[model samples]
Target: MLFGPRPSCIKRLLVIEDDPLTAFDNEHTLKHAGYDVVATVDSGEAAVRFIAAEQIDALVLDLGLAGDMTGRDVARLARDRGIAVLLVTGRCPEDASDIAMACLDKPHSPSALVAALKALETMICKNRAPRKVAGLTTWWRPAAA
Candidate 1:
């Protein structure tokens, strides 16, 4: 241990999206943005399996997934395991702020998605307030002193 604080790095990610086209785009965009896309799954079951087995730093989860479990279910599970989450949907769920680090609305640009993740990383890992970015509703707050 040579450091006072661990490095703030949010790298590996799992994307759970029901739409094949959107999933592809999210995976492609995140990889281009320098994140390791560990896996892109289309259902909650697959997402659960990945969550149980993989070392994921974050999730890009679609609210309406193609399985019994909704994105909120995955978000809760991921949070229990200390993984961060970024929920994506047309309309955000009512309890989104409780379960995710941030939420992003649908039909957003790839650049906007990338920016949202950057902002989330700053807030979650760096513990610093991030500048506002379009299409992101952040839920991260600094821990109380």
Candidate 2:
């Protein structure tokens, strides 16, 4: 039998923000928190591709991206792919869409984002068993940890 140790539990995240300053700040903070930032893009289109390519465990998505597609669109796509989402934006509550994970308004401190990500990570970890949602069973760990 081929026996090997389970892979490391490094969490991967994708950041989709249009503002240059915000993107830089978020990338710096998330990296400092030990998340593997797979990709940082200014457009929702690019963000979608990054999620598709990487084993993205979560997303720190902005509500306003610099492209025809909005951040909500990116969130929806990511959710469909079983990627946990954390919405950070200055937009109003009513503007929020059907995101699965935590949501935080913009102008938030790095600590706040980190807390939300941690909660999302815990939620994902607890629900590692395969679940059928929307008639689809998304990829999830076997609670081996």
Candidate 3:
């Protein structure tokens, strides 16, 4: 629990990365940036499982998973459930499909990741959800609360 208190107080992020090293680095960076990482799954299947069982506020999903399912699939699932998403990939999608809260390309620095998370938090708060996006999202009506 990086942000502290509750999931609502810390922007909860679900990471679906296929590389263990990258996932670890992203988790560490996100923790330092004050986010609560709900789950770090290496495959799209696990990502779906994690989301189904946890209370995730947003997703930092990799476009390439180790399994058959892609990040876009996970994004679609999350969007269907009203969860915000941040796509971490090399190329950005061009369509007006379900817009991700933000997008970060590969080889991102910790500072850049932190900034993205902060930006995503802001976007989530501004989405007419009556949520608070202070140093955290504790001001909103949390899903678990």
Candidate 4:
């Protein structure tokens, strides 16, 4: 297996953020946290193509991408392909729970990001809902799924 059954299934991540600084920071942080960041792209189009070509375990998606395709577009494709999505939204990002695992609002700490991902990993692996996280609102409907 590419990844083992434990520690963990959420190890491979694809970061899709338009802001170069944010992308770099996220990549650095996730790497420091021991995740194998597959790639960091700044456009939805690129994200889509990359997802089609790679075996990513999850995504850190920014809704306000600078490309022909929107982040929602990428999320839909990723979800349909059974890849987990972690949304990164601004102050008023559209609620896209239908296509995402959870939403993490902007101006959040790196620890919060890591917490959210761990929560997501638990939810996916255990098939249970996650508890509340700071600056995060989960829309995962595990039972319904």
A best-first ranking of the candidates according to their lDDT comes to 1, 4, 3, 2
Candidate 2's displacement at residue 18, Å, is 0.5
Q: Which window of ten consecutive residues has the lowest lDDT sum in model 3?
A: 133-142
lDDT of 2 by residue, 47-76 (tens): 978877788888888888888998888888
TM-score of 2: 0.76
**Deviation (Å) of 14 in candidate 4:** 0.5
- lDDT per residue for candidate 1 within 1-145, as digits (tens), equals 2112222477899999999999999989888777889999999899999988889999999989897898888899998998989998898878898899888999899888887888777987678887897778888689666
Task: Give all candidates' CA lDDT scores.
Answer: 0.85, 0.70, 0.70, 0.84
In model 4, which regions exceed 4 Å deviation? Answer: 1-7, 92-94, 143-145
lDDT of 4 at 14: 95
The global Cα lDDT (0 to 1) of model 4 is 0.84
User: Cα RMSD (Å) per model?
Assistant: 5.2, 8.9, 6.4, 3.9
Residue pairs with backbone atoms closer than 3 Å in model 2 (clashes)? 89-106
Count of backbone collisions in candidate 2: 1
Could you tell me every candidate's TM-score relative to the true structure? 0.91, 0.76, 0.77, 0.89
Clashing pairs in 1: none
Q: Write the per-residue lDDT of candidate 4 for residues 79-112, one digit (tens) a residue.
A: 9999999998885356677879889989788878
Kindly give the stretch of ten consecutive residues in candidate 4 with the minimal lDDT sum.
1-10
Q: Pick the winner on lDDT between candidates 3 and 4.
A: 4
Q: Count clashing residue pairs per candidate.
A: 0, 1, 0, 0
